[model samples]
Target: MTSPLSGIRVLEIGDRIATAYCGKLLRDAGADVVMVEPPAGHRLRRYRPAGVPPSAGDSPFFSFLSGGKRSISSPTVPPELVDSADIVILGSTPAEAADLGLDVDEIACRTSVITVSNFGWSGPWIDVPATEFTLQAWCGSTGSRGEPERPPIAVGGDLGEFIAGSYAAFFALAAHRGGGPFDMSVLEAMTTSMQVFSWLRKELMLLEVLGRSTEVPSVERAKDGYVGISMATGQQWQDFCAMVECPDLADVPELRFQVGRWEQRDLIRARTADFFATHTVAEIVELAALFRIPMTAIGNGETLSSMDHFIERESFLSHPSGFRAPRAPWRMSATPPLPPALPPALGDTDSPWTPRESRAERTGLPLDGVRIVDLTAFWAGPTATHLLGMLGADVVKIESVQRPDGMRFAGGFREDVERWWEYSWVFHGVNSGKRSITLDLGSEEGRALFGRMVAEADVVVENFTPRVMENFGLSYDELRGFNEQIIEVRMPGFGLDGPWRDRVGFAMTMEQLAGLAWLTGYPDGLPTAPRGACDPLAGVHAAFLTLAALEHRRRTGQGQLVELPMIDVVLNASALQVIERDVAGVLLTRRGNRGHEFAVQNVYACAGDDQWIAVSVRDNDDWHALKAVLRQPVWAHDLIYAEDTADLIDGHLADWCKDQPRDETVSAFLAAGIPAAPVVQPPDVIDNAALQARGFFQTLDHPLCGPLPYPRPPVTGHFVNSAAPLLGQDNAQILGSSLGLTAQDLARLEDDKVIGSWPLGL
Candidate 1:
């Protein structure tokens, strides 16, 4: 079968997860990707899971991300190859690229160039060093993770790099369509994961107004393991009560409302804990599903590997280790992704390729002429529109006075503040670069207005459940009547058609249900949700898929319904475990801070209060470097130490780290060529030298929130960086200009509450 990106040539020059995964995506899409590494092979090839030898070609980490691509041992790119490639992805710092004679501007002129770096190429701290641990901290994700009292803990796995690669692939594809050169910073992409905490911090203002604290727990221990539970809506609360056989608790005055339940969190936790103590994770999962409650067991690698759902879906690829690896995230009916193949040996150029001249340059942003009608609220849907807007699409965000986006009222600071809608950072963060208008779709006049706008829109995107558009007489079929060429992208939690289609889906619940919660957290601890990474993750997928659909439309002049299941997106992101279960019949479980790929890997406490550093020894080379850095400590000479005595190794390492300052220790290890980094917190991230140098954060002046620093899109391109529109801020402009409504008409509409600048009662 033909692939979507057939005939596309992608040249990848990098050695870590970010560039490797990006190349994998393009290769899966049928792009001819050639990965260039040194003669000794890339450092990433040495990364092997415990008991797996590098020579065995069974390093799950490498096999999973580096498959389906050819490799060369050239340290430098051939000018002829660079000129002929469709896209060139550079995974290097500006200095490194310069040293290799890879000129950013020169290569960009020849073909689409995506430069992925720790910070960025032209930033002040461009030379500063970074690692997954430091980047997560710098992105504000680390500070918001873990228990409140405990020191901040970075999320396991290379999440920062993973997110960066996703953005790189998306942007590279966009650039391939004449978007131009783009720079991607791993630190910036990781910040998207912290959007939830950014909102929660503002929500703390509301807690202060209510005379309550800002602490709340989202996870609880079950009889056998941990279960993630969320009672966000009244119905969910009732379902939870029913599932737990505590209908009386649901009726309690203090538990009747979300805020009340939160205020009495201690009591709620006590009661819930007592009830959960009697139920095993499996029992709770069954009950939760039966009652339609948003609950799921914290899954370990083992459980995820054995899931029947993944096996039935054929979500894994067989690896040589007698195991499986995850496949591509999305499925296309017409052009599916390529099957996984083993990575090529260094300098292996056996694959055939016909080099072609680069295409002519396009003058504007990739989506400059595209028009999108956005009806999304909260995180995931809005994220898609926001990204589209940055790509230069004319996005009209349709909201209503009576039912404004829940995000407008999310941050706590708005409760006692005037013009609270304008002051919501949560709303502003995702809604930036898009225009907002008010129209109550439930009303005939509002529906009529939307129909008129739909006729001129190229795409209509929404995240409401399946029936919402149908209820409003705005389903894809109905909208196609308004504009036959309009693309409708529907983002539902489970999917447009499924057993759980009608059920409400939230990031927390989706994470649990999709098996991310099961894969995260400590092995013996409760399954924990890492803020809301799934939301942004789903949003990124939604945006990438939308672009792909647009490309199809460009080819065939055809528009169709695009349904992106949030659960499916999350499942794809957590694809590693599916392999373990399907191929080896072993359920993957959590290993806490312990590393599965290396014998010596952990986070150790540092000299200062609540400070720590993450350390990982990839192989004997890293181990020897660490030993030298530690001045040949006695534990380093132990015979059993080389055989995966991780606990004993970590204990000794902790003792050494506790007496050393975080930065000095990390720097020393790094100098000794060891993989180590200081654990970063949010405050430090805001002022991080590397990020600051790269100008990763941009300041937007808002009417109410004043000037605030917002992380720029991880991708570099000719895109707009603007503040979010105020509630209904663009009603008059959009209605008057696009729909040809007169001033008097807009005035009357506002007077009738159909279009208003401010939210109701604000």
Candidate 2:
């Protein structure tokens, strides 16, 4: 079968999760992505899981991100090849770019480039060095993420940066259509994730106003195993009470639930804990399901593989190197990216093609002919389209002086700065092969131009609050009036028509309101949000909805609206929580890092502090492996043979894990045919040996970010190169040639500031 992104060629420069992930999406969709590796190779290549070998090919980071793309090694990139390539992605600091003699202006004038850097190329701290932890701390996510009073915790993985890259990919596609070498900020992309938190702060203001100050209980563990529960809606509360068999909760006057419940939640929680102890997990889950209360067992990425729903739905695939990942989140009827290749070795393929003339032709991107007009600024909306761009859509991003997405300044940078787009490590990941066009949508002229673009577009996506569209006179009805085939997707903090519809929110706020915050972190502690938790998951939902909308449009020839309230999406993810509350009257509290049931669950630290292991026991089949490594007969002899071993499992497992090296144990178990793997650290993920054998990470040389590692494309199939773009780099050629704009018109647009070559003062 023919691939979607056939005949598309992409050049990825700055090798980070964001750019790499974007390139991966494009490659999955069938684009030919050529990753340029710096002299030292991609940084992620050095990252290793505990006890795992540290080899370039073993980098899971590289394996997962670059599975489909080819790698090229070069420290200092020449301009000729970049100009000829369809996309160029670079991640760097201003100092780094300048030191490397990478002139953004020169590149923009020459070709389309997507520059990914620390604080954008023009910001006050544009040259500042940063890491995932620092960004998380700077953004207040680290401070706000875990228990309220404990030392702030960074979210697992370089999530903020990764989501930002996803957003960048969407913008790149948009620019690809509008034609540009455009600049985007990882910071702006990350800001989208903060919406919930921002809104929560506003809600806190109202609490102070109402003089409803009250002492709340910190989250506490119940007698049962650790479980994640939520109470987002009034219905959820009602369901929760019912699941725990507490019909009397309907009469509890002090609880004052809903959003207001947050301040007084501790008291209500203490009172509610007594009720949860009465039931088992089975009862809680069965009951929650009957009532539609949102809940779930808190789990890591690896644990998701064993879920019956996931297995039945076929959420994982085994690569050649023996690593399995969740299936690319979306299922498409046509041109799906599949059959991921293993991570490559440095200079793995020998081709004597000169950089300038040997552009890899990409005609096989999964969603090649699809068109998307992306209006998303931050994490969720941008992430959705980023995935779409990977699937081969022609995505054009709308930007303007009046309104720039917050990520432009929020990922991890000072407020007052120009060229803030470059410092965004996050932006580099989500966007790769899109196009860019600046328009003042709030102005009549801009709106008119947008309407014209919509008339020629297939999809319109935005993650702004619901009313923003109506205020701009750009609602679904308005857009459909212009183009009946358009699909409009709106992702608000909450649903468009609810009591809390106007309430502002970010990722934190959503977690709070969704009841997820109330259930995370250590017991008897302050509420906490997931680490960059909502963005990627929400992105998955958005991408799934877009594909569904596209399929619907295909059949009906009618435009449709796709709405994803961030809170609702969270509830969907936490469906298990809802089930327990509604049917079983179970009110779940928090449990820090502990797995539910504690039956064959753990991510233990190894002797080498940097290494770790993720283990699970579905049944009793893997007992021997655990027994062999732990040197305890209880696991195999006692637990397996005993009629009732449940009571002793947790204590025995804890004792066995205390002194063992997580990675070595995992390796021993895996060698013994057990289900085990070391917990992969963000930096170490790029060097996982199994991932290397599977051909995961692809290398790309960039002018700025040096030789970098990009995660391979998620889908496995007959796709090729997965490169990112240079900002507005394609502007002159596309406007002058494809858009039929005369040189005078291009000059006029530039003069009018309707569009500029780069947002940064290149």
Candidate 3:
């Protein structure tokens, strides 16, 4: 079957995960992607897995990201080929691109160009070196992870780079139908991907103002292992207590509401902790599912690999290292992805496509003329609709006046403001570019109005539990009856048919359940929540699948239901651990901030309070370069140190770095061609020069917030209406324009409480 991107040509420059994975996505969609590496080949190719034959030339990390793409060693490719390409993905800094003689403007004029970087081309820290750890730190994710007493720990693997790559692929595909010179900052991508924390932080500020406590237990240990539990609603809390056979606690008035539970969290935690200690993870999971409680085992690599669902779904591809690699996060009936293939050898000139006639001129954004009815709240589902909105879809977000999106009230900023909803940067950030209309789906009139809107919408999206749509009479079958061509995308924590389908889950709990928490943190320490990365990961998958469904409908003239189980998407993101467990029959364990693949990798203290730098030495050349940068100290030249004795080398490296400024240490190591970066915090990320130069942050003058810096979506060359609609801001416009409802009708609906511009109590 011909893939969606069959005729497209993608040129990937740089060996970084972001660019490589972006190319992989394009390749999966049947694009002819050619990766260009330096003369020595890409640095990632040298990342050899233990016991792998050298002739294989396959590094699990590199192969997983760069698979199904051709390669060329030369820095400079022919300009004719560049001109003929449909997209160019550059993973280098602005300086590196200029040095390579790759004119960004000239290339963008001919085809789309997406430049991915650490901070961005024009940010103040654009020249400052960075790594996954530092990016997470600067983005606020690391700071929120683990126990507050312990120093922040980075999440396992290059999740920041992985997320940036997903954004790059989405933007590239969007630009292909339009045109571009887009720029993406890994830091910004990571920040936005996990923006749910921003909301939580804001909630804390409001709680403080209201004299309320803000404390909750994210992870707790069971008899054999750990499990994550979330009781967002009072009913879930009651169910959890009942499942544990704690009828007395379930009846306690303080444990009835989420706020009351927070106020008396210490007492509640002590009781639950003891109860959890008496049960095993499997037993807890079973009871939670049976009782419709929001609790799940903190699975490890072994548990994930042994799962029947993933194995049956064929979520992984075989790896040469006896492990496995993740397949694309989506599948389709028609226009399915191309089969996976190993990354091509450097300088291999194999081309998958022959010259074709120039395509006809493309006009508006890729999703132009499409309309979506968005019934999602928080990050994941909203993020999907936001991306679609940026791609020129007319998205109408429906919220009830009685139950507004929590983000509207959870502004992370402390402002002397009157109307709180208008000042919510968290809500505005993700909801921008979409219209808003209030509809109480519980009401008969509201349901009738929603059906009318769905009839005109091409897509309907919701992230509620399995029973929500059915309860509201807005399920896929009902929507299909209203409009046969309407595509319905449902994002539930578990799938619709599973025993756990009714269980409640947030991003934090889902991460633990999917084994991400167990894979992070110190070796002997407890599991840590990796913030909200799972939400954006799921969001990206939902958006990609939605587009695929749209394409299928375009060809077949039929629409279908798209189910995106949040747990499945999160597990797929951590495919490495599953693969390792599958191959080695052992669960992967956390190693703190240490690198598993590199010989010498650790975070070391540097000059200044709380300042640090991360360094990774992969081989002899890297060791030599690092030693030279450190002034060739006697200890650095030791054979034991050179032989990958990471624990022993870490102490010596820490001593060496203690007196050196973080920037200096990072610069020296980078200049010497060693992988090193400073641990930048959130304050350092703001007011960054590169981000400023690239206009990564835009100032939107909100009515209540005045003006605030909003991070632009990591894509360019498309219509981005930056204004986020106020509550029911588009009620009149939408009612009159689409549904032909008169102002009197809207007033009547408002009087009947079927529509409103603000929350009922507020």
Q: Is candidate 1 or 3 superior in TM-score?
A: 1
How does model 1 fare in lDDT? 0.71
lDDT of 3 by residue, 1-762 (tens): 567676678988887877887787778767789887888898888654332223455556676667777887776656666776778888888889887778887777677878898877654666666666656655655544444334556787666666888788877776666645677788778877754434323432344222212235557788998878765555666777777666688787666654566667777778778778998988887787777766777877677655655566665567545566656655544466787677788889744345545545677667889999999987789889998887889999999898887667544334455565666655777887899999999999999999999988899989998998899987777998899888888898776754556777877777887777886777887776676688887887678767766766776787877777787667656765765555445456777877455556777778887666767776687777777777778765665544347667777788888999888877788777776765554434444545566676666665554555666676533345667788898899987677899989999999988898978875
**How far is 438's C-alpha from truth in model 1 (Å)?**
1.8
What number of clashing residue pairs does each candidate have, in the order they appear?
Answer: 17, 184, 8
Tens digit of per-residue lDDT, candidate 2, span 260-312: 45555665676668755665544554465567554443433323345454455
What do the candidate models score in CA lDDT, each in turn? Answer: 0.71, 0.54, 0.72
Best by TM-score: 1
The alpha-carbon lDDT assigned to residue 380 of candidate 3 equals 82
Q: What ordering of candidates by lDDT runs from best to worst?
A: 3, 1, 2
Model 1 lDDT tens row, 533-646:
777777777787778777777777777777777776666566656654554445555566663455677778888777778777656777777778888877677534464466
Error of 3 at 299 (Å): 2.1
Backbone clash tally for model 2?
A: 184
TM-score comparison, 1 vs 2, better candidate: 1
